[model samples]
Target: MSKIAQELASASTNTEDFYADLKPFANFEQLTNFDRYLPLPDDWFIGVADVVQSTRAIEIGRYKAVNTVAAAVLVAITNALPRLGFPYVFGGDGATVALPGKYLDDVRYELARTAAWAEDSLGLVLRVTIVPVSEIRAAGHDVRVARYAASENVSYAMFTGGGVAWAETQLKKGEFAIHRAPLDAKPNLSGLYCGFGPIPTEQGVILSIIALPLEDQASYRALVADVLTLIEFSSRRSGHPLPEGGPLPSWLGGEIQRLLSRDSPHANLLTAAADALRAIKTRIVLAAGIRIGRFEPSKYRREMWQNTDFRKFDDGLKMTVDCSPEIAEAIEARLIFAERSGVCLAGTHRQKSAHLTCYVPSNIQSDHVHFVDGADGGYAAAAAKKRRVRLPRGTNGHYRANRSIDAGERPHRD
Candidate 1:
């Protein structure tokens, strides 16, 4: 074999044995350079969310609580973005998310809806505004900004309370009289408190929202659902979920805390921030998903693949995915009555979490997979990763057919 071919073969053999060890790239300057290097998707969808009147929370003797809630909201929004097929940024007081160009309308509706809902649910007013990229630059702000990549999260909600609502309603209703006409005198809110500027997205949509009143709650939810439905329909027509990253779980704060404590001297600084951030309602709602692997040594993990039957698929058979041994065992308990073999294997270490693969043999048909966890609902197989496939119960063929045939569909059933 050619040297290149041999090298490729050698690298392929070690793929499963490799996992990226990421440290908190917290240097703002380094992050800025990284942002420039990050090949952003063309025609992104962007939205800015920021808190309204967070100062009031501080004045009301809930300053610490407010900060915690703010961080939580940001985490929640950040977590949900991956699920919705968007890359997001967590500004200290707000967030910016970018969706694919094709998913523009869907993103617009869903983001707006989510922002509104987060406002009500978290008891914090989050204002979301959207604008095009042209507007972003026209306003003299660099829209491409970065927070702590892989480590930090962001959140915001709509405005509440009668006084704030009244003021916001008047603003929307053109109550602010100006020298220029209503359209001509649009307020330029750049770098305001808890305010987000314009955002550019992969989906031709650039959205920027400042403090907007949470007036007409029903209308906002309807708009959100409508946008989501549109996105779903588009996804069905295109047969994909506008591919992006995955949702993160909020509990990841704890994981981050542990990792920092174990590896870094400045763990205290980061941990304090993580603790305060996790207390926020938004982070709780939009946390990232991270699963712990069973406490097997690295050597044992390397050999785990040898025991599994990755190629065999029995008729009516399927695979169950779990985060840890306990989860896998619980799932196994549910499948006690199945007449086929059950194979459980350790998942690769990614980020801070581990995955488990379970081969379920059964007589069921239609080639579908089920996820029992609400947090990880509609889970799908990951890319560039080999997953075990359980074929129909009786056919018993090698599962080599699991090669990806479509953009979104992978070996795992959703």
Candidate 2:
């Protein structure tokens, strides 16, 4: 092992509080400051899960299904390892999570099961794998993480360094591959759903952007900061895609998807009826802005909007914003200029509106998180555009980043 890896392996054994113990920053811009991040212990493992042929799926108008399966990776792992607080990022078509070595077997099993479940239940192939942090260090990459507290009840994980991007590249190359479990295998996907309809743009359009540094990290950070400044200056809520009170749930948007994700292949009449009733109750509560038992609909709506992961940094910067045509054009022009100047590689996609997928562990809790993307194609399309650009030799290439929702220095306000 490398000397840094040796030190990391010996530095600490108390892994339970690895993420919980880190001091979190409230400002999202602090993500560009490397000092805010801490390196993971070498004994930790990074797990990656992604849907194969996602572009094909998205092309056929199954973006919501794609988002749900991607979110399922996080939901399943979070539900399985409830006691441990680990950092994870949600890419539009996949997710990346880091955990201690002790839970490797458990996580691997869950990932395998999740992959199998996706294939059997959702008809999407999920590729999953777990790699050791020490190996990553030995390969001259590192995984450094920071916590951005978007709200009191939720803090999203921000990842820096090149380690995450590297692991993903390896997974795509068929290294450290984890085979899917038996068809009967199921992951704990209790809280996963894509219940809301596509969010109509209040401004003009929904834009998804993915940008990565092509040169040094310093220049990249500066460029990202400038991009963020443009985005913040262009809109009231820093280009947040959701409305003030959060999105209204569609009458039967996610019911079938939820039923399909259950343990059984077929949902019986009673189970389907129960699920529909629950959906109806939820719609009534949110539509009427009423408090049912411990659940406060209005407060939940506000928190949900505040906690949506519309902008984030995994290995690089990824954002999905709602803005007018002028702002979107200006931002695109700036990125094109940056790409031409050899500062970064970037791609963007625009749609009529934005899509949301949720993992609400409970309706009453303020900690629930929602994932955002362009309703038409979102990050997947943006990434495809980015890939069309020819990368120089030794270029790190594109990798999916984290998905935790965070706010910038200017938090979204009603």
Candidate 3:
């Protein structure tokens, strides 16, 4: 085995704190620095959950439902393994997580139950699967991960080495697929919420982008750095989709969806009434900027903006940013030029506003994380648009014509 692979194998023997042991880098721009990522242990496993026909659902204005169901996968798993810190990414319509083999069965059960609940309650078919890191390596790819500390309490995972992309492709082809649990099965989805309405862009539009390298790793890294530099040059906070004060709760934002996700016998009128009251209370707190017993509204809002996964890396670069018409056009032009030069393949979509899906363990804590996407159609649409184009040859002499690059479909926030 290679030296790094051997080290990873050794680390697998004591896997409990593998993720926690790695030092985290605070800057998102350093994502292109290959040395920051470490190979996952050979014994680790990757779990993938995807929503089938998500594009169709988005077309019918069910984007919020789709985003909620996608985020639910991670929330369920996290609640199940509260003491363990794992790496996960949330796609607009799906999610991917990696954990030690010791927790494999537990995670599998949660994922199966989550799939069952999504279909039964929301009418969304969630495909779930688990693949070993060894199996991925055997297929000629590796899963290397990095930690981006978005806040003091939250650090998002950035995946490279292409193993995640390979796993998603296999899952879609019915390989290593996990059967859904019984219809009545339920996963702990305690903190999942889609309470905020779409944020209208102060910038001209919301742009969703997905870009992949068509050449060597070095070239791809340079391309990513260039793209980030362009964004920073436009405005240091141009990529932040939320406003300075954070998002406001909508009357019909996601209360019904949250209520329906529960399978408890007590999920009746009284339960819904209680949830509605909580929502009203939250609105009042945010509107008045009040502080109530350890939960400071202003401080929470600042953390929410900082904690959002607006731009992330999962095998490739995926971002949802709010920018003006001129900035968006400039980005698109740069991507097109890079594509023509055989450096990368990219796709972008534009909308008037951006959406937010949140997982708040507690309003009093700054550890909560938010997921961002274009309100109408986000990464799924951008990926679909990308597949329509003919791809170029890589520096390694491989033609990507028949290869599917949409495998890494989610946001990268643990």
Candidate 4:
């Protein structure tokens, strides 16, 4: 009816108030039955950043490092172009961000820098690719998307139509692989943090799972609904899945306050130094527990909320959860049941604690978000588990039967 809707239906991407239109469907109640998300216009781009040979890295105990690289791309890009708004979805190994055409060059600069840093600092092969939306449409796919606001301060971009997936496939195939640049400076990752280890909980356990859908959207949606119902019950019986006191310890907040320089990458020496001074001052204030310029625990908590990059939807459903032991058991049972009943392909992993990686904006104490995954292995491991299921394909074209370990079968998490 309206121009935006018309453009969306016709595969034209518009970021202007994009999430506002989808706010009504942000929660599971409406999203499970919604018609479809909007499609992107030709004037947009899709970026996929990931660690090459990530599975091998995970196997070799570099899983957390891999996550750093994944969130690093988003942090670098967003910091580089703060004025331009975009939507991003985090995969445990990498991330997918969509934005208008104007941000492409800046995005490339940051991605190159990030890839270089991953290789240089972390010894991980980070791959990045940026392709125009038109290229995807030409390949006979669409990048339909929805905004899922998990909390009041956080919203993730969910994708359908297979275009975003196609782009990722291309990147994996080395078709559009953007390589690392030889830069003297590291990617601007000032506020990113990993000093705090996994938050301890009573009977602490992290549950990671992936559920792939068949073509029948309703069936898959229903399956997600079932999973949510279990989680809701568990939350009522136990506490919220997120850490209750927001990852304890007095020095924790200070440990995460990074000094960021907001001067333009092209700024003069004087401006750069001034920005650096400002950053150090802010970090000192935050680290010392002084509340100036909205720099306090409440603000930090919101930053964490905005960046809770655990639950996401792409070709499959993925999440890294922390819950009470009993709750974890009940949720696992439901996944097994869903798979056995032909709802979707199921892949799951259980661990002691969830992994956390952060992306703090140029401001040390504000505009930060934390990404979470299962500690030993997160989404990447779960997806690997899903791939091993040699089950019969159901009518929905998904691998049938659940491959999740029975709660009693393994005590690896316990």
Candidate 5:
């Protein structure tokens, strides 16, 4: 199959050939290395929960017991998500979840209820960040999971006897939302960090989520089942729920429409966007790609192509989207076509523009967007499945000497 594809890539200049050309230079190999990274969908709503004082648990000689308790909480929470029609990840000190647009409110409410339960029963503190899926999707990057491992050890050493325990985090990003949860938050154990930008894939969107233990694991898992149920129900709904015939739900369509009728400015923008999206088919693709896991805004983009944010990457084109779920879905569908053609998509940059900006490379065909070597510019032919040119002509200023890097050096990306 690869041989046939490669031959076609070398033989033609059609869109298929474009993919073929991109194939050889494509970064599909990066997906296999996801143990160090993760590929999360954008546009889905998500829930995040964390443990309160994991470090104290270790100090109190409850490390072993707390770990078990934490695991149990995660199990229950994960279980609860599915039941609630949502899907979730059991982060070490916390958990992250995803929900369809229809179930967004239900899931968020349930998570709040569950958080209260966890705090009371498990003696943990739970904080919630209800973010736009677009925010999280923008911060995807590959970090050596090993990097966290090293940091964990260093944190433990600093605390003396009851060193920080190993923990994991869960993250979900999309055109409309981003959700994150961490296992621990102990000062020395782990640092809860996040970023928003593009990931290497068909999507070209990214978001980051991380957590460090702060309290006992017992508190972490307190509301496991409830959270899991919520997610499950939402997932099921995403697949099976019937659309409303005329009247929309109170949470989204109905309210938004009502506001628009009243002539609110934001409502008008949303209405216009919604109409434009439906009237025209936007190319939305889903790609599996790599990410740079850990990031610090201050040190972002110190190196030209080596910047922490996608904005500083060498790529000439970029698009950072902050949209509603409906809008995100439209974009994702278009990308799916690109993915089949083997487009190398990635999560790049923390959000530089308040709204998602689609970068247009000077060399990119008007009809097609080529995702390629950013730091060291290159052209990609997805159907050709190879990276053809090393550096394309007319790269953007940001595409030049690391100068295009983020000026604020502080990112609210994830």
Candidate 6:
């Protein structure tokens, strides 16, 4: 057999490990480089969980709740495969994770469970879909991925090749609706938190924005860079919009302390006592700046600052920006220019407080990571706006299928 044939055979086998071992890209400076991407194996699958009609949900002021339910899928799946190292990216309204066929059934089961949990506990509708790499390829695309280390503890997944993008469209178009099945497991969400509110900037307001590429536009990345500048937000700040170590706000600590518990405040005596003790201890160490094993607040903050998932590109640019009202106006002006230039479409929301969602390894010191989004209506709102704007048509008939996104479909249900 030819060497290329042999390589293709190997690629079909060690799917996840292949990309996991590829050198991780370092910063936004190299965002446009295509060689960094490694092809996903045909034996793997990509799972997406997005809140249906999230724009409407955000309008009703349930953005924080929406963020949690969307991130809940990641927390659940990681816990299920604690020892495995896979790639996942957090979106304000949902999440995307990829793994090999070996874990397909387990991951799907988790998706079902997460979907049900979102609807039942959170009163939000979640549409989940799992598409095989073969299916992605059959649709004339490949799932390529690269790992980007945002910091010492946070390494995010970056995807390209238009495969995952196609899968998302297929999902929205109802192509994969038959794959959804009944789910019965309860998600393990111990580390998720909405306790902290938005960080106020006398600047004006905090904006959650999502920007998608304009078909045939010169460079979406450059357009996003301009948008960030107008907002006076340095792409340098980490993707986490909130600083949880408590230098900014203190009074909110009491409410946050209560929300940290896993059990109800009205639970029986013993449970309540234990919950209270744990909450207090967590607050003291985190707030008082105590150093425990790997719980150094200062170092973690630095890492978060350097390695946030904001200003990231995975077919589009989605970020949480803290902008003053003046800066917001400037941003609008720039966006209008870009829109007239037929360059990009953006959705933005200004609100108070930021939401934090976490994926805790059974061993917290290992590979735990947290995701953050704007409080009321983060990138979800931004994405909603982007959705309404028509996708630009490529000069060559466009890479996207002809159909518009089926915004009303529930792709996760069988």
Clashing pairs in model 6, backbone N/Cα/C closer than 3 A: 150-307, 197-353, 198-353, 198-354, 203-324, 204-324, 204-325, 239-308, 347-382
- Residue-level lDDT tens digits of model 5 in 55-105: 344345432222222333333333334333223323223444444445556
lDDT of 1 at 100: 43
Clashes of each: 55, 5, 3, 3, 138, 9
Candidate 4 wrong stretches, greater than 4 Å? 1-26, 183-185, 236-240, 249-294, 302-307, 362-366, 386-414
Give the residue spans of candidate 5 off by over 4 A.
Answer: 1-41, 64-87, 137-414
lDDT of 4 by residue, 314-336 (tens): 65576666666787787778777
TM-score of each: 0.29, 0.90, 0.92, 0.77, 0.26, 0.80
Q: After superposition on all CA atoms, what RMSD does each candidate show versus the true structure?
A: 26.5, 6.1, 3.4, 7.0, 25.5, 4.8
lDDT of 1 by residue, 1-414 (tens): 733234324442322111111123443223213222221222443444444554444335432223323333334333344234233433223344444445545444444544444343345555554444333222221222222332132111111111111222222233431111121111111111211111112232111111111223233333323323433343321111111232222333333223323233455766766654653532333232222243222322222222221111111112211222333333333333121322221121111122122111111211111111101111121221343332111011111222212212212211
Query: Candidate 6: worst 10 consecutive residues by lDDT?
Result: 390-399
- Measured with C-alpha atoms, the lDDT of residue 260 in candidate 5 is 19
User: Tens digits of per-residue lDDT for model 6 on 40-72?
Assistant: 767889888788777678778776677777777
Error of 3 at 372 (Å): 1.2
| Comparison by TM-score, 4 against 6, better one | 6
How much lDDT does each candidate structure score? 0.27, 0.78, 0.80, 0.64, 0.25, 0.61
- Displacement of residue 256 (Cα, Å) in model 5 is 45
lDDT of model 4 at position 7: 59
Superior by lDDT: candidate 2 or candidate 3: 3
Q: Candidate 3 regions off by >4 Å? A: 9-13, 252-263, 386-414
lDDT of 2 by residue, 1-414 (tens): 754446457555786677888898888887778667777887789999888888788889888888888898999899998777889988888889999898999899889988998888779999888889888867767788889887788888888667776677677768999999996788888878777888999889899987766655667777788878888998768999999888888876574455553447575777777766777777888989888788888999999999999988776788999888898898889889887877777788899989898888887777899888888988878766413222221213222232211211100100
Angstrom error of the Cα, residue 334, model 5: value is 42
Task: State candidate 2's TM-score.
Answer: 0.90
Candidate 2 residue 205 Cα shift, in angstroms, is 1.2
